[model samples]
Target: MHRVKSDLLSAHIGSKPSKTWRAICDGIDVLKQGLIKRIGDGATTLIWACNWIPRTGIFRPIASKVPEPPVLVSELIDHTSMTWKAELVRNCFFDFDSDVILQIPLSMRKQEDFWAWHHETNGLFTVCSAYRMLVETKKNREDYFGSCGNCSDVQRIQKEWKHLWRMKMPSKIKVFCWRLAHNSLPTGSVLKNKNLANTANCKICGAEEDTWIHSLLQCNISKCVWALMDEDLLDLLASLRFSDPKYWVSYICCNIPQADGIRILVTCWAIWYARRKAIHEGIFKSPFSIMIMINRLIEEFEFVQGIDFKEKDLYQEKSRTHNWIAPQNGLSKINTDAAIDRTGTKGVVAAVCRNDQGGFIAASAMVIPHITDPETLEAMACLEALAFAEDCGIRSFVVALDCLNVVKNIREMP
Candidate 1:
C-alpha cells in the first residue's frame, strides 16, 4: 500500500519510465478522484486536499483551497468527545459543508485517518464501484454523452431515473432501465445505427424503427404485458411515443404512481429477458405466462417489503415475526429493521418507537444510499432508533434489533 501511494500516487514521472509504469502513473488521478478521507483521528488528512464532504459534486470545501491553507481535519474535531466540534465546523465552513460534516456520524473510538472508496458504503473498493466511478467522472466531459440536448427539458426525465433507482427491485432491472433511458439498448434501430444490423424495423410490430420505448414499452408483446399488469397505465401511455426514449419514460413516470412504475420497470426487464430467450434458447411463452412470472416476482419482493410498510400498527406480520411484547411501565421500546437490495449496494432503514402500552411514540425511516453489509445497516437502524428516542424525550428506552451480530457486539463492547 505504501509502495502504491508512493510510486503511483505521488512519485514524479521520469523521462524513461516504462509504458506500464506511465499508464499506472497516468491513472493515479482517476484513482485518487474516487478516494475519500474517512476521518478517524484526522491527524494525517489535509482538510483542503482530502475528499471528505459527502456530496454529489466536489468533495473538497468551497471555502478552502488545496495545499495553500494547510489545515488538518483534526482542527474540526472535538478531541474530548471524538465528535465533530459543531460550532467550530459551522464557524469555519459554509452552511452546506457544515451541514454535510455534522451529519457524518463519527465513531466513539478515535482511530487513525484512512482513505476509503467514496462510491461504496463499506469504505472498501471494488471493481464495480471503480467502474461506476469512472463512468460518472467521464460524464463531466463535454463530448462523452455525444449530446445532452436540453438538460432543463430533461430534468423530469432525470427525476424519473432517480425514482427508478430508488424503487425496491433487482439492481439489474435498474441498470437495464438506466441503459434504456440512455437509448443504449441493443434494439433493432440502435443496432442498425451502430451498423450491427441491416434492418431497423421491429420484429414483432413491423414498426419503422425498434426504439427503446417501442421495444420495451410499446410493441404488441409489451402492450400485452402492461395490459395484464396495469391496463389503465397501458391506455394512458398507449399513444406515448418520442424519438428519444427518455421523453417517453419521463411522461410515463410523471403520470403513474411509483408502485406501478416498479411493476412497469420489472415488466420491461422481463420482456427483454423473454426476447433474448426466444432468440437464443428457442423458447417461447405467452404474454400471460410472462405477466404471471412478473406478478410472482413482484409479489415476492413486496411480501418481503410488506413486513416494514403494510402493517397499520407496524410489526403485525405474525407469520414472519414473533408476537410483539410491550415494554415495562414508564419505558419505551424501539424496533428497527432495514431492507437492502440484492447486491447490498443500498438499504432502507426504519425504526418505530412505541410506549409501554404499545402506542406509537415516534418513527423515522431513511435510505442508505450505499451499503456493504446488512449488519452495518441494522446497526445504523439501532443508532437512528436511539437518536429518535432521545429526540422524543424518552429517558428510558430499549432498542430491539433483529441482528444478533450487532446485539452481541454491543453486549461485548467495553
Candidate 2:
C-alpha cells in the first residue's frame, strides 16, 4: 500500500530524476495517507501531494498552487517542513538576537510542540544549544544594532527588551547588589585566588585570614559579635550555606523581620564601626567594647519603643514655658517639617498652643540635624516633644501638623 502511494505521488508530482524530488515524493506519500482525505481529480491530487511535500525546505506553506509537472522542488519543501518557522522562532540563535521572547514557547504553535518534545526527551544539549544561539544573536544585535547603554554585558541584557523597555529593572536585582556592595568583603579589592585567600592569615586579628565564607559568617570577629549578642548568627549562616553571596543577601533581607534584622544590622555595623574607630582613634577597643555599643543601641531603641504621649502635650508644655499659656481646655498643635539637601537633611519640630478664644499662646521650632527622611524626622520631632512634655509633667494635649501625612501616620501608630 505504501509503495503504491509512493508511485502515485511521484507520477503526480513528476518522475523527477533528482534525489531530492524522489525523497520528497516518498515523504508526500507518507503524509498523504495520514493527512489528505481525498484526491478526487488529477489536478487536485497533484496539488494535495505537493502541498504536503514542503517545496522550499524553508517550511513555509505555499498558498498558490502550481498546476504543472516538474513541480518546483522549492515549493514542495516550503509546504511540507517548517525550517523558516524554526529559524524565526529560534531567533537565529543567541548570537544573532539579544532579546528574550516575552511569550512562552507553549504560546507559539510549531515551537510549542518542538519544545514539548525537547523537554520530554530531556534534550539538555539541544536546550543549551538554543540558549547559546539566542545569546549570540543578542550580542550581535547589541554590537551592530543600538544597545541599551545601561546594559553592562550580554548576560545582564534581557530577552524581553520590548516588554521591559519602559519598566525599570525590578527592585530585586538593584537591592541585592546594593546590599552586597555595602556589607563587608573588601568592596574595592578583588581577591586573586579563592583557595589561597581562604587559607591566608586574618588581616585584622593576625589569625588565619578569612575567605568569603569567613568574612560573611565564620570569621572570629563576626562570630565574636554574634556570641556577644547571645544570638545565633550561625543559624543565618547555615541557611545560606549553599547559596551564593547574592542569594544569601536576598534571603537574609527578605526572611528576617525588620525589627530583629535591625539588631543584626546594628551588630554588624558596630563591628565595622569599632574597626574604623580603632584605626582612627589609635586606641584599639576590645571586642567587648563593640558588644557594649551594640547593646547600648538596642537598649536605646527599646527605651524609645516604651514611651507613650499624645502630640498635644508637647504643644501645651511649650506654651506654658514660654510665659504664653493658653486658656484652659484649648487645642494644642505640633508642626513637624523636614528639609532635604545634598549636604544633609534637617527636621524642625514646632509646637503651638491655642486658647478657647482662638489666640495663640506660644510656639517654638527646633532643628534636628542628620535626619534622612521626612517621616523619620517627623517621628523624631514628635518623640522629642513627647519626652520634653513628660519631663514637664503635662498630661493632656493635642498635636497639629501642616503635614497631613505625618499626622495620619502618627495617628495610626499602634
Candidate 3:
C-alpha cells in the first residue's frame, strides 16, 4: 500500500541480517515499478513522467518536439463535458500515443486518479501477474524491464511459492513449507548458531548435525518415516533435485500427482511434529504407527471439508433466492457491501440507508487502502453504517450485513 510505503519504505536498512525487513523494503521498490495510474479525473497524474496509458507498453506518452513546461493529465481533458480534448490530444503527442489516449474511456462519475497494476485488466496488482511481467520480458534487464541473470532462478522461486500455496493441504503445513524454504525452522544447527543450543547434533538421532535436510529427510526418524510412505511417493521425491527444499517443492508442483503431493506434504509435517514431541515429551512413536496416523488424519480432513459437487451447486442455488426484505415498521435499515481486491491489498466499501418503505435516506462509499480481507472490510462497513445512522438521527435502525462470521461474532460478543 502507498500508505505502508510512506511509513516503512524510507527506513534505513542499516548493516543488519534481517530477511523480513529486507523483503519489506524490496517489495516496496517492486510495488513502485509495478503500479500504474488509472485514468480517472486525471488531475493528480503528470503527463510526461507517470505511467497512465496501459496499452502503450511503457505507459507514458512521447514528449512533444516543441519544448513545454510541466503538464498535468488534467490539462488535456475537456473538463466541461468530462471528455478528452481530441484535437488537443492529437496535436500534443505522436499518433501512436494519441490513439491509445483516445481509446481510453472516461468515467462519467469523474472518479479521482488512482494507482493500479497495468498487468491486470481489472486494475488490481497480483504477485503472479507481476512475476509474469518480470519473466516474460526477455530483453532490457536494466533498461526497460525484467530482472537479471536469465530469470530462470527467479521463475523457479516464484513457482515454488505459488505451488506450495496452491496445494490442497492444511494452511499450517503450507506455512511450514514457507518456513522450510526460508530455512527458518529451529533445526539443531540453527539453534546452535543462535546460541540457543549447546550442540548442533539432532536431539533425537544425535548421529548428524540438525540441518534442515538432516533433520527433515536424512535423520533416522525421518528415514524411517519416508520408508513407511508409499513407494511411488518415495520414488517421486528421489527423481527430483533434493539439493534445496525449495527446489523439491517447485518440482513436486510441476511433476508430481496432486494426491501424491498432498501425501508428501502431510507426511513431512507429521515427521516434524514427531521430532518435536520426541524432544519435548520424550515420546517417540514407531514409524509404522506414525504413517497410519498420518493416513487417518488426511482421510478425516478431506471427508470433513470436501463438499459434494451437486450439493454445493444446490446450496448456491438456494442462496440465490434469498432476496432483500424491508425492515420493521418505523425502523430504518442500512445495507452495506464491499468489493475486496486481494491482489491490490485494498478494497472499497459502500453503505446505503433506507426507510421501512424502501425509500433511500442516505448513501456513502469510500476507497479503503491496505485492506485485504472480507471480514475486516465488512466489519468496517458495519461501523460506517452505525456512524451514518447517528449522523442521520436514526436510533432504531437495523444493520444488514453479508458476512455471516462478522454477524455471529457480534451476536456472541459480551
Candidate 4:
C-alpha cells in the first residue's frame, strides 16, 4: 500500500477492483490532495508540483514558459554546500517563493525524500483526519450554496468567535461554550434535531425545551443561579432581550466586567454539570449548591492565574517555586518530575533524592511507553520517587512535586 504512486490514484478506480481495494484507492486520492514533501535529500520530489515549501504549501513557477522536463527539488540545492543554490532558485522562482524554498531545512541525517500527510502530526494519513476534512468541505459547500436566511446565524456566531476564544478560561471550557453558541452541543434539543433523542424537553424541569437558551438561561435552576448575580449585571442581562443563548452570552461578555462575565460562564457550565449528574447518577444538586460550586471553581481558577492576589501579597507570603529546596541537615529532599509529549502517547518520569547540602544521593529515570493524563504521570513520578527512596534505605525524607493537586492528595492520605 505504501508503494502505490499518487499519480495513479484515479487510474485504478472503477477498474473491476474489489470493494476494499476501491475504498483504499479512493482514500489515497483524498490523501494526495493533502500530501506534502518533507524535504530530506529532495531527490525524488518534483520542484514545482510538490508541496515542500512550508509557508507557500506548494511551489509555483514564475516564468511564462515551462521547462522541457520537470525540475527536480534536488536541483535547487547544492549538495556540496548542503544549502540552496540561491542564484539558481532566484532565476526559476519569484522572490517570495524563492525565500520560502530557501527556508526548507535540510535533513541532518541526509535521509531520502518522504511524503508527509500534512493534516496529521506524525506525517501519516489517518481516517479521522480525512473525515474531518470532508466534513469541513461539506460545511464550506453548504455555506456557499445554502439559503441566505441562515447567513445571519453564521454572522452572529462569527462575531462571538473573539469573545468565546479570548476569554480567560481553560481551552476545553471555551470549546464547550463555542459548541453551545453554535447549537452543536449535545443538549436534548440538538440530539432531537439530529434524530438521536425522542424529545427535547428538559429532563430535570420538564417545563421547557432543552435548548441551549432554555438550559442555560430560562430554566428554573439557571434562573436561580442568575438571580444570585449583582443587580447591575441582572439589569444589563435583562436589557439585552436576546432569546438566543449565543447572542446573549456574547453581549454579556462584551458589556459586563470581565470577571463577572467569566463567573456567568462558570455558572452556565455548573448548571450543565448539575444536569449531567441528574441524568447519570440521579443525584441532583440545588441551584444554591451549584452557585457555590461555580464560585469555588472561579476562585480556584483565579488563584491559579494569579488574579486573586497581587504581586506584593505573593511576595509577602512564602512562595514555593517549582524547584528543589534542601531539607533539614540530616534529612533528604526527594524531587520528582515527569515530561509528556503533547500527543500524550509517551511519558518520562524522573526522581532524585538530595541531601541538605544539595548533593544528589540517588536518581532514577523511567520511560513510560503509554500514559494519558499528565496528573497520572506526576503521580507515577511521586510513587517512583518513594520507591527509589525506600530502596536507598532513606527514612523520613521530604517529598516535593510541582503538581499541587498531587501534593494535596498526599496530604489527605490516611
Candidates 2 and 3 compared: the better one by TM-score is 3
Clashes of 2: 42
Q: On TM-score, who's better, 1 or 2?
A: 1
Q: Give the winner by TM-score.
A: 1
lDDT of 4 by residue, 1-414 (tens): 334455654456654677777778777778766777787777998766666764322334444232553378887767875666767776667675665566555532457897776665445677888887677557766866875244434434554688668777878678777777667867788888899989988887896478887787788878988898778667766677776666776775665666767777777788888888888799988878887887788878887775552123221325557455678888889888888766755677899888989997889998664353567678778877877887899997988888887777666544
Lowest lDDT 10-residue stretch of candidate 3: 308-317
Considering only N, C-alpha and C atoms within 3 Å, which residue pairs clash in candidate 4? Answer: none
Clashing pairs in 3: none
TM-score of 4: 0.40
TM-score of 2: 0.30
Query: For candidate 4, what is the lDDT?
Result: 0.71
Alpha-carbon shift of residue 214 in model 2 (angstroms): 2.2
lDDT of 1 by residue, 1-414 (tens): 213445445775566777877777777767787888887888998888778876566888888422344389888877887667777776777786776777565554547877777776556677788887778567745544677544532334455677667667778887887788788888898899999999999876789988877777778887777777545657656666576766666654555555666666778889998877775686977898998888788888778765222223221234576778998888889999988766755677899988899898889997764353567778878877877877788889888888887887677544
TM-scores for all predictions: 0.48, 0.30, 0.43, 0.40
Model 2 lDDT, full chain set = 0.43
By lDDT, the better pick of 1 and 4 is 1
Q: What digit string (tens of lDDT, one per residue) describes model 3 on residues 1-414? A: 213334443455557637876787778777766778887889999998888886524778866844673399888877786668878887888887776677565554557998877776556677998787776553545534433443334435555688778766778988987887667889998898999989998888686688888877889999999998768667777776576666666666556556666677788888999999899999998899889889887786668756232132221224447666999999989999877664754677789999999999999886665454567578768877877787789899999988997887677554
Q: Give the per-residue lDDT digits (tens) of candidate 2, residues 226-306.
A: 776543555655555543554454444445543444455566556655554554586666778777877776676557654
Question: Given candidate 2, what's the lDDT at residue 29?
Answer: 51
Ranking by TM-score: 1, 3, 4, 2
